[model samples]
Target: MDTIKKYLESMFEHLPKTLEVMRAKDELYSMMEDKYNELISEGKKENEAIGIVISEFGNLDELAEGLGLSKVLDDLVSSDRRYVSRQEADDYVDAVVSRRFMLSLGILLCILSPAGPILLDSIATATGLNLFTGIGVAFLFLCAAVGVGFIVFSNYITKSWSFLNKQPCYIDDETIDYLKSEKEECQTGNGMLLAVGIMLCIVSVIPVIVLDAALNVPIISDGVGPSMMFTLAAVGVFLIVFSSGRNKAYKKLLSLNKKVFAREILQQFADAPDNGPEKSVKIERVTGEVVESDYKDASYSSYDKPEQSSDSTEKKVKNFIKVMVKDYWKSVLCIYIIWSFFTFSWGSSWVIWPLAAILRKPIEQYFLGGKH
Candidate 1:
């Protein structure tokens, strides 16, 4: 039944959120539900019934045009099964804005990185001060710190917004199409920006070369090289930051995250529903008292031994370990090797093993929604 709802939601995702569209979706859900119930009554298994219903009623183009949402039919036909809600759209926009601001600040700092060194050199030349003084070294460190800080802070800001990686609660077709279009457009823009940035970086050094050879300006020649290099680095940083932000935004809209919905339909073991009425089971307590408790129908029988439960648990743990290694063994190996190379700290490197244990659930959930 939940599968039916998810399918209907995916079909209607591209449509406008209008009253007419809502009416169409409701009518469609009712129709699918009726078909599902009829199939179930015929003794068909639940999975087979769902498959039949979906195949029969999955086409939605004509329904969309009839509902006056023909404008989105092209997208519906082309889009994969993905959806996003209005709130999610708004949240993505907010995240992009915040990320853009941090990236811009980082780029500005990179651009200014050479200024301190150039200014200090100019002051030394003018005042006849020694260039290798303690003050000069301190100024150099300050400029380097600014550049490093900008890079680190920008990365931190971007990582802080990683919560957006979670699957959205609701999604629709229109949202999916919009994101696809935006991703395409952003990719094109990034390419253009990269070309322009490369051209500017190449041209930046021309001024210094021309000043030294064609005009013989020693002061300007000395300062321009550092300035040009800083400018080039800034351009590279900007391109990286801007392109990454766009990619993240598009990924969110695409719902690349795995999502799972599980529904348990309890079937009565008795031949007649009335004979079972409200099902209950009897359990003998350690105190030797027999108690009756409601028991939902499940595949496992009440007569199963306790060892069966233990075996199931053991199998799940083995599966979890297998998946963890399959997904992250390379990363774990790299971390260990890098730590060992720099600090020769094999003992501390072992900490990553425990860290992997802590992260196991999240990594599994990311790829499999925590299902084995």
Candidate 2:
């Protein structure tokens, strides 16, 4: 039955994708199916048959040694890496997916929340009455409540993964290798996403601008401009957040190791954009202008020059950025909430996120430059 298949999948989800392990999984499934069929033929109820089948074969720990998984299990248990169970993986992954959507949907809801108010305001402007304006304020509060609910629930659900910050995640080496390939096949390719997402966001305000400015439509300022801006910008944000979340989740899973995770964080500072400045310092010959960079201009001629950073300084910088990145997102959350409530100018307000994302790189580079 489908239930047995799902259970089987979940049970093996954390196991290595070794040929021996995979063969064992298939053989076990076939055996269980046969037993299930026998029970059904003997007038056993469907639930009863499933229960018996699971009870007989579902104890993975008891059967692991016989299935030639003793060595794998022993290695995982003895190593410094944490051995993840099927249930743990499921919970963590669910947390990742749910939390991502929570953020995405929350932003979308907040951006669109003003639409009703704007519409009501437009009606009030047309009718010259205060009734619709009052109703619009109430509607805005309702929408804001729903948006906050989404964000809070997402924050709560993501608690399952919060402990990952304190420790490294470790799974089987064989499983890690398998996951590498799986990730390649399914990765969201953020390069394209970044380009497309940023482009969409940059252009999201065009509708409002075109309507109000180029078209010389006074009605646009009354309400339609902001409503359209929210709808469009929210879609762009939804595309980015909803699309990129899976890739981020997979990366989190892979970087459960501290070294790998640290490298990932540090690399953000190391990598230069194709059109961005070089990593090493360069001097402009004609202008005699000094161009500072992430790394010092090291050469045989500069033997007397002190090195870029001492080990202590480098480690401190690393910790600083790690904390900064974490806090940066929290700051962003606060900015989103506060500015959204005060401005109520959805057209201008929704643009903050797109602009904030653009600012993230420079802020990181600044800290990397020892300006922290």
Candidate 3:
């Protein structure tokens, strides 16, 4: 009886016309009840009447057919599942904006910082400003132009690039749905990861520019702050390289992160109907085919462990966060390394460089050996 109940439940789960099948079953039960009462009134034994009614209920095929299992099964096998989300799309856009902004900022700052000295020198030479006051005015004007120009130019370029690329783009619901239907085996993907990575590279260049501006101070009075700017640029280059590498790696992982719609397929089964022969035959056939000897040995369990939660709306959000972190780890790591280098050059070098060099033996054994 328990086995029978389990089988019935399993069959019920697979029906597509579940509501109609259940309604028909309920009607059949009602008919049985009425017939049983009349038999009792006609002097048949109660248990005998019950036995006849149970027998008359017949096989499971009638119920299966009533539910429409065939079409649902077909859809499940042919469906392509998608693992992308809006969060990934948005994150990618942010990354692009950040990286592009950073790169442009660095370039502009490097130009502007040195421009101050050249403009001052030109004025000094042209006006014969041997006076301290004349030199100071020329320098001030150059600095002002560089600073203002940097702010405006960087902003303009960032906006223009964004527009040109048609980025800050979003994944439409239709596209997501299509992916879901086309890639039936996997849910996660690399498209959004790539997008975010590109964005990050674009935005990470800004801080380098800001730092370069600060470094452009006339440290030696001659027009030779190029060395400092060069070093800063090198740091910027390394950061960009590391970030780009990480983004590429993450994009690959994201692309590889595929998902099978186990829940959706299972739900299709649960939605099967319980009345009629056509649906019953389809259900039985599909289930047999899905669990057949050869097919069972394959990797179809990729979509296993389907969730039964009613909060699937929330599941999308959680899935997005997971995918985002997984896809952006490289970017994050690059950012950290670059940040460390940046801070060391300007901020922590005073304390860190001497300390690290003094402890070089251990530092080399750890970081150099890749043991850290």
Candidate 4:
């Protein structure tokens, strides 16, 4: 009974140490189990099989070294309280400010160029503005003013907006411990930048719309409204493209592609303090297993085999497609309703509004619910 407890404890001691090198303990456990089953199939008894499993756990000192545990431990012990780093605060500020400005700019642009143009053309043709030189001149002048407003506002907003210097983040002991143990490093790359941009774009839309309507010249209302909406659409599309590029860049940056990193981590572990009971236990286990054979017999291998993962990834893909399809459907219905209303006034146009009213509810919810 004592031996079993000792063996079990012995087997798990490396887990805590390995936690410092791993992304997730569960992934390590799964990897270990797979290795253990491979060994058992080679005719080793259960205890020997377990021993073999413990023996091949790679270099702990190297892993700890890679994770920078020595620095982490020293920092934790030395700290009187959790203090936020200047860099982290700076990151937060940058993120917030970028987001706010992108939003504000997007809104301003949308409003200044509102989607009233297409409807204006429709109204102009129906009302005979083309034949009337006076009315056509007025319409042209209104468009020119809206175009100038969009350019000036967009430039001003983009230039004036800047990220702040201080931002909020976790500075707790547990957070530091987890980050240190996992050896997971974060790089605030283009994705965060892009995220801030997207959020700002979405939020700015409402404000842009309100401002455009409030500033409308009575006769130029229809033309200005559509112009603003179209301008906003263009900005949103541009931001989406920029955000996508940033994400791609970030992914490429995190692809640690060097073998030297493994050895470096091992060295870091070897230098870490050996004072704590947990640290000592992990060191002993790694030291013991540094020379184990790496073979796994066929019979034991089956026990550690990965289960057939449910098609969850497929389900997620389908769900995304479903959402997109629903959104496309709603947008189509909305456009149809609007076009019908503008073309056919009152009796026939009135029916279009009721139909739009029915379709608009679900479509509005879809867009509003999904917006960042």
Q: Tens-digit lDDT track for model 4 on 1-372? A: 233334434433322234453443344456567777787688778887766655655443433444455554454345332234334434433444454345334333322322344445645655767544444445544643553343344333323222111211123333334334322333344456445545544553454457557875533444444444445444543344334332322222222111112223334454675343454345334432221111112112344467755577976776665565444423333453455447732112212222332354465455443211
298, model 3: CA deviation in Å? 31
lDDT of 3 by residue, 168-222 (tens): 2223334344444533422233344334434433444444455457664443223
Candidate achieving higher TM-score, 2 or 3: 2
Better of 2 and 4 by lDDT: 2
Off by over 4 Å in 1: 1-84, 100-104, 107-112, 126-139, 155-170, 257-372
Per residue, candidate 1 scores C-alpha lDDT tens digits across 204-302 of 546556766765444465555545545554564355345445655666556432221111011122222533323333111211111121122232245
> Poorest 10 consecutive residues of model 1 by lDDT?
259-268
TM-score per prediction, in order, is: 0.44, 0.56, 0.24, 0.25
Q: Assess the local accuracy of residue 334 in candidate 1 as a C-alpha lDDT between 0 and 100.
A: 48
* lDDT (Cα) of model 2: 0.66
Best by lDDT: 2
Q: Which model scores highest in TM-score?
A: 2
Better of 1 and 2 by TM-score: 2
Q: Could you tell me the TM-score of candidate 1? A: 0.44
Ranking by lDDT: 2, 1, 3, 4
Q: What is the lDDT for 87 in model 2?
A: 56
